[model samples]
Target: MRRGGGGGGRRLPKSSLAPSAASDRTPLLDPHVLHPRNLDLAFSRRDSDAASLCSSRPSSIGTGPSFAAPVTNFSDRASQAAALRVVNAYLAPAVSLRPPLPSAKDIVAAFRCPFKLTRSALKAPGTPHSWPPLLSVLYWLTLLVNSSESGAGGDDSPAASNDLMLYITNSYSLFISGDDDSVASLDEEYSSKARAHAQAAVEASQALEKEALDLESKRTKLTSGPSRLEALQAEKEALTADVEKFEAVVKSWTVKIQEKEESSVHLEKELEAKLMDQQRIAAENEELMKKVDAQVVNVRDVDRMQREIQSVERDNVKLENGNATLEEKGWELEAAVVGKLEEIEGLVEQCNQALRKLKPGIDFQYMLNTKASSPVELLGTSYKTIMKPALNSLADEARRISILKHDESVELEKQSQRNAKILSEKKNHISVCQTKTDEMVARLDSLDVEIGNHVSRCKADARLMKDELEKKDHHLSTVEKESEEFLKISEKKLEDAKRETDEEIQMCARELLKLIDSVTEYKEFMETSISGMRKDLYETVDDISSLASKAASTRQTSAQFVM
Candidate 1:
């Protein structure tokens, strides 16, 4: 095969000849050229030379022109040949000497030369050796050569062409047999692709059909107009009712939350006030303790004052006793002085009687002693003056002592009265201080009790508030969870509805496109034939347009709802 020597006559065992691909790339044949045309060019070219079909150069055989251009050029040749065949069949009874021409089927088969060549070429494996292309070129040349030679005037040329045709056909069969497995595999693969494509198309068509039926049913129901409209209105009313009920529930919960917040604020204020009052009571208690301490000092001072007063009373009693003893001693001294004065008076009387008795006797002797008596009289006068001065001084001394004792007694009574008054005043002061201290203690105790109660109440209130706050937080979290779940459910429902709506929209669009294609073809066919039918067709077009517009609007609304 590599030496290019396997061109026409090579053969091999069935297994060794299994076909393989030349390359992974797709073949260059345009499968769109289904039929042939331009019979004149083909026939003229065929008659121009016999040598063009049997060129010995392998390059000339392997690489001719591309198949696309030639196939297009000969597009209508098959129809012409068929027409000629028909004409020939009708004229066969009248004229019988005409040479046979290739039939329409043969002409079409000739046009397919390029495709068959490409397919065979692609099926070869490894190196893109020249055999398949050359074989294809030979296949084409053989057909042209046979077609041209069949109509030749010489009988020997016809037999030669027949032998050539037989040789070419056998060679083509051998080449095909060499690569049979590859061709078969390719055919199987293509068949599978075609089957899959057809299945998909059928499924799509079925889906469109179902959608069309659904749309038709929906249209019919909607066209009933009043009944469907009434049903929609009823649904709207039910939805509005549900919305109102939910709104009411939301409002009530909001109100309850607001009330709870207010209560919490009030409780906070009360607790603050209670704390402040407790602080104040504690301050007052501390002040009372300070005052009680001061009062205790004052009471101690009062006690010292009372003790001093008691000592003063004791001194006053001693002074009073000393004054009484002085009075007794004074009385005794007065009595003794009186007794001594009486004794002095009796001695003076005896001396005076003796002097009288002696005066009678001494009258005789007085004449003699007259001069001596004058001296005695002078001594007596001196003695009497001295005695009077002394007596006066003693009486003045006694009066002074009595005046001092009376002044001392009066001073002692005044001091005793003053001491009693001072003691009573101090006792009254002590009693007042004690009462005040007791009052302060009671007030402090009351304050303590009140402060304790406030503290306890504040603690309890704080606990209650904390519990309520926890409850509120729990309730709020539950509400949030419920709301989230509700939102999720609504979103899921919207998504599902949106998905179904998108499917419906796609289905409608496909159905509409198909309808438009059919309608266009029909309109083109009937455009000039029926003006009256055209009016109805225009009306149908308008209806289709309106339906498309409605479908578009419904899709937009559904999208918005999904959003």
Candidate 2:
């Protein structure tokens, strides 16, 4: 496929390109542009994309900034035409007809135009063969050319001088002029801001005036009310008195409540301590019962061992007698079998020699007749003919031996199987025992956790009780102090009241005496009742401990039996 190209433009693959950045010391007025060789080449690329995109393609495309007043006018137009042509080609598939890029007339006309631009104060030719910096400037300028709006770019750029920023405009723009420092413009902005602030202040003053007038009117109404400062003060004083009276009553009530709570806490602590004691006793009883059960288990184990030993002794005696009798019989049988075996060996040798001589090629009877030896004659006789009978006997003996060996092997296998079965049973028993131990350990751990939690709770309760006791002590001290103060304050009044209310006081004294006598009697009765209750509780605790001990003993005994 053929691809379109833009005039005075170049194409570069990003991957094939290397960037050359300028050093900090390089001046802005450097006269370097894109690589010289890259500038002579037409904008063409292969191996990758070939689209007619309006992208920047820098290649030594620059002229002196001073020459921009003449060249930028027309050169930029030519560049624009080329760019437009490329853009048209890109959109040709969608829009069939398009005008050629800015015609020659437009390029010529643009050269005669004028544009406001910024110029750097630094002189060009600031460095020699500063290609590195020149390339860097071109890189920055290339970016500017590519991104500029309306394509307002050429070899010239906006001057760095402060005077350039202001009065800067495009061909038909009224941008801010450049003359003063940035601070001057900032000052102007601040001045306008100050004016706006003044206007805002004026408006705010008007609003504040209305608010002040409204506030003055509200003040007038507030002054007109009948509730004076002194009256408010008096009301506040009355409320304060009520608050003090309520506070005093609350204090007294709280004091009484605290005293009652203190006593209850002490009583609760006593009850908890008693319960703990009972539980501890029960636990100890259980432990003792477990020990007793262990003793029983040990006794049972001893009896089992003794019985096993008796059985083993009996088996040992039986095996010993059987071994001696079997040995004597085996010796006698061996002697008889040995002599018979020698005779059978001689006969076998004789038969083998005769069989070799009795080949089909040779007549055995003739060979025998020619030999005429003792062995040969014997071979041809009845004794030699008995070889078949002897061989049958040997076969039978071997069969008997094999049968006996097979029987013994079978018996040995059975015995091994039985022993293995017994061992498996023992292993199963051991595993069962281990499993029980693990379960017991789990139970013990659970019990320990429960006990730990209970202990922690008991400690917290004890601390709370101690706090209550301290609070009670503090209240008691406060009461004692207040009573002392009251006695001091009312000593004279008390004497005078005693004199004036003597007759009523005597009646009150008599009533108090009777009340005291009744209280003393009640105290004695409560003491006796409390003592009886303590004794009953002790008995109950003991009985419960005994029951727990019995239960523990039963459990232990049962466990031993299971083992």
Candidate 3:
């Protein structure tokens, strides 16, 4: 039985499996086999002579089912993990069933029979011994037995065990078939093939012999005798003359090629110089652009400074107006204080006049009391009552007036001091403001100077740039002129080279025409020679045919005798 038979027999129902994926479709495998029937029947191993078989051999093993799964897990990591799971599942049982290493005695015992048989077979060589195939069968049987005994069962154990049994049975069948039958069959097949190959080889050899004989006969006929020595001598002389003419033409061509090469070198040098000039011009242009950009930036700065100066001037004007208003307020405060002082002085004079009037009334009352006794007594009482009251009131009025004057004077002095202090503070503030204004003016003037300097510098730089540009322009113009002159020279040289080449080509063409005429003459002579050779060849051919016919008759008779 074939090695694939067991694997091929494991095919489940068609309903459980799908067809293969189309070539263009993304390939996928079923995640789990969904057996429609779920047949739990244990498959018995096919009847054979061997004790056991293993199904690990690669054969017609079914790869479960094809699933039309979507391409969702496209990541390499997912694919790798899936592959690892598959490998682990497949290797698990194999690893579990792996046989332990044999001891030395067991190893010797295991190989002893086969080794002894091999030795005996090698010794008895003429017996047509065969050990390799038998040994392979034995090795497979041993593996089947060991794996079956040691294997730990899993989900796929039944299928694997069935296949293993089938492999063992197949190996047993091979052994039962026997070496004698296999050797006999091989010998018969080899013998038949050898016979056919021998027949073919014999026919090939006979044909090769006939061809060799025919060639020998033709060679003999073709060598009739040497002739036409004088004609060949004449042809050789003509060929030598053509060779000399060709050499002369070749020499002239070499000279012309050298001149053209020299002119090309000169032109190449001129082109390189022109390229360098162009590169330099490009560099100068870039420099000019950089300078222009810098100038634009400087101009922007100058404009910004001018705007700042204008704003500063406006601020100075506002500060000046504020200072003027403050000074006016100070003058008004001083005038109000002076008017209050003058009013205080007028109050002092009015107090003094009231005092003078009170003093006369008191003296008049004392004089009336002294003049009348009983009248004086009564008068004294009246005077004391009335005048005393009037005198006391007058004195109190006088004292209150003096105190008011003193308080007014003290307040006026305090007001004057306060005004003085205020004026001094105002003066100090004005001075500070003036200083700030002066500083601002100075700063404005400095800014103006700076702007003027910047303008002057910009102008100078512009002038410098103009001068540089003019220089570059002059240099470029000179380079252009030089390039033009060089180009003209190159053109002139190219024309000269072309003319020289044309003359050389014409010379070569004339020489070639002469050579062609010579070759035609030589060809005509050779044609005449060939015609004579043809006549001779025809006679030789006739002789060779007669000789070949005689040889064939002799060969046929010999072949018949041999038969």
Candidate 4:
């Protein structure tokens, strides 16, 4: 409990009691006299008297010499006795004693005192040179005792208190010595350290608050996960149903398309058949046209036939006129012949009359018949007979020629009639052929018209079919677009959902990492604090043990001196 002693000492008093005004006048103890060599010499000279003097003194002392009192003369026996009693009282609770006590050298060694001390310095009749060393030792022992007691009390550890006190004392000393820079530097250092610690604590608190908010958000997300998942599942199911419906519609459309294709194929086959029929009809019409062309007579052939008939008629008329002229000439010639015959007859009558008159008819006949009657007689005899017979023969020949001319005329008339009839028949035949040809041409025109109409009808049907197919194509395209849009929407929704889930996962992973880092930092801080505390405890224990040993040795020394 006492606290007045050396500068390094903890709670040791410089003396047992307050100093009197007379004691204050004495000079303070010399630091050099407390040297180890002086202590050894003084203890050697009074070794015998120290034990008796220490026994005769009382254990309790009310007051003692002040720190300023000189110990060079070694004359203050009461101060010595008071110093011994204080050492005994301070050590009694710390050490156990036996009958034979140990020496002061042993006590000094056990205390691990920084100063050199000897047993002779603690004994009675101690030398003045040993006094300061003795007081120094007592002061060290008192500090040790107080430190030990404080450690045991558990109020505050002596080592920590002592370090704080030392720092405060150093700061005050620096300030008193006018070392303002050093003091300010130290203050700044401490202030900076405090600021650093406060900043670190603020940052840590902010980090904790941020972490707590993150955890809360994460918990909220976790809590809502099932509901969100359910919603997504429902949406997916709906999309699946829509897809199924779309697929069904597509299937139906495909079936309809197949039917349409089959119908179109059938219609194409029918159209082909109609086209083939039309081609056959066209070929037949062409053949008929060819036959008609072959049968049709040219106008030049009819004109030539008509001209030939006119030429034949003209030849017949000419032949008839020639016959008539021939007939007239024959008539004239016959008349003249008749006239000559009459004249001849008359003349013959006359001649007969004359012959009769001149010579007799028998005689004339006989003379003509007579042989050689001369050229003149023969000529005369045959003149009338020859002339008569020639006349008769000419008549007969003329009549026969007339009859032949008549027959020739009749034959020529019949031939002309036959030719006229043949010409008329040819004309009629040509007209019939023309009429038939006209009919065929008309029929060909009708067939051509019908074929054109059929072709137009077929073209109309094809146009209608094309329009229908285009309409169907437009409808199908619309349906396909709708399906594609639906699918795209579903895909987009799925992608968005996936993105959200990924973000959540990443956020959770980051939060977990942050928690792990905070835990690691806290663990390291605790480990460092614990290790420092353990080291401090070990140091305190060592100091206590050393002080305990010193107290024990001092107790042994007091007991020896008391004996």
Top of the candidates by lDDT: 4
Total clashes for model 1? 12
RMSD vs true structure, all candidates? 55.3, 57.6, 49.7, 61.7
Q: Put down candidate 1 lDDT per residue, 1-563, tens digits, no spaces.
A: 11122222222213432223312212222112211111112222111122332232122223433333212122133433333443344445664545688753365466655432223233542222323333334434443443344334223321222223333444565467797665566556656866897899999999999998999899898887678679899999999999999999999999999999999999999999999999999999999988888763577788999999999999999999999999999999989967965665566667556556633223211111223336464224543554456556767887999999999999999999999999999999999999999999999899779867766666666667667556655645554554465455555544443444345345434644564566576677777668768888999999999999999999999999999
Over 4 Å off in model 1, which ranges? 1-205, 213-232, 235-276, 288-563
Which candidate's TM-score is highest?
1
- List clash counts for every candidate, in order: 12, 13, 7, 4
lDDT per residue for candidate 4 within 85-117, as digits (tens), equals 656777677777686877777877776764555
Q: How close is candidate 4 to the true structure, as a TM-score?
A: 0.16
Once fitted onto the true fold, the runs of candidate 4 whose alpha carbons sit more than 4 angstroms away are 1-179, 224-236, 245-563
Considering summed lDDT, which 10 consecutive residues are worst modelled in model 4?
A: 1-10
In the range 1-563, model 3's lDDT, one tens digit per residue, is 21333322222323423333322232123222111111101111222311121221111223422221111121123332443454354445745535687643355356442121233333443331223222322332343343343332212322222323333444555467776575556556656866887899999999999998998898687676445786688889899999999999999999999999999999999999999999999999999988988773677788999999999999999999999999999999989967865664566457556656757365332332323336445234555565667778878889999999999999999999999999999999999999999999999899789867766666666667667556655645554554465455554544444444345445434644564566577778889999999999999999999999999999999999999
lDDT of 1 at 175: 62
Error of 2 at 560 (Å): 99
Ranked by lDDT, the better of candidates 1 and 2 is 1
lDDT for 369 in candidate 1 is 22
Q: Write the per-residue lDDT of candidate 2 for residues 468-508, one digit (tens) a residue.
A: 55665564555455445544545534444334334433443
**Candidate 3 vs. truth: CA RMSD?**
49.7
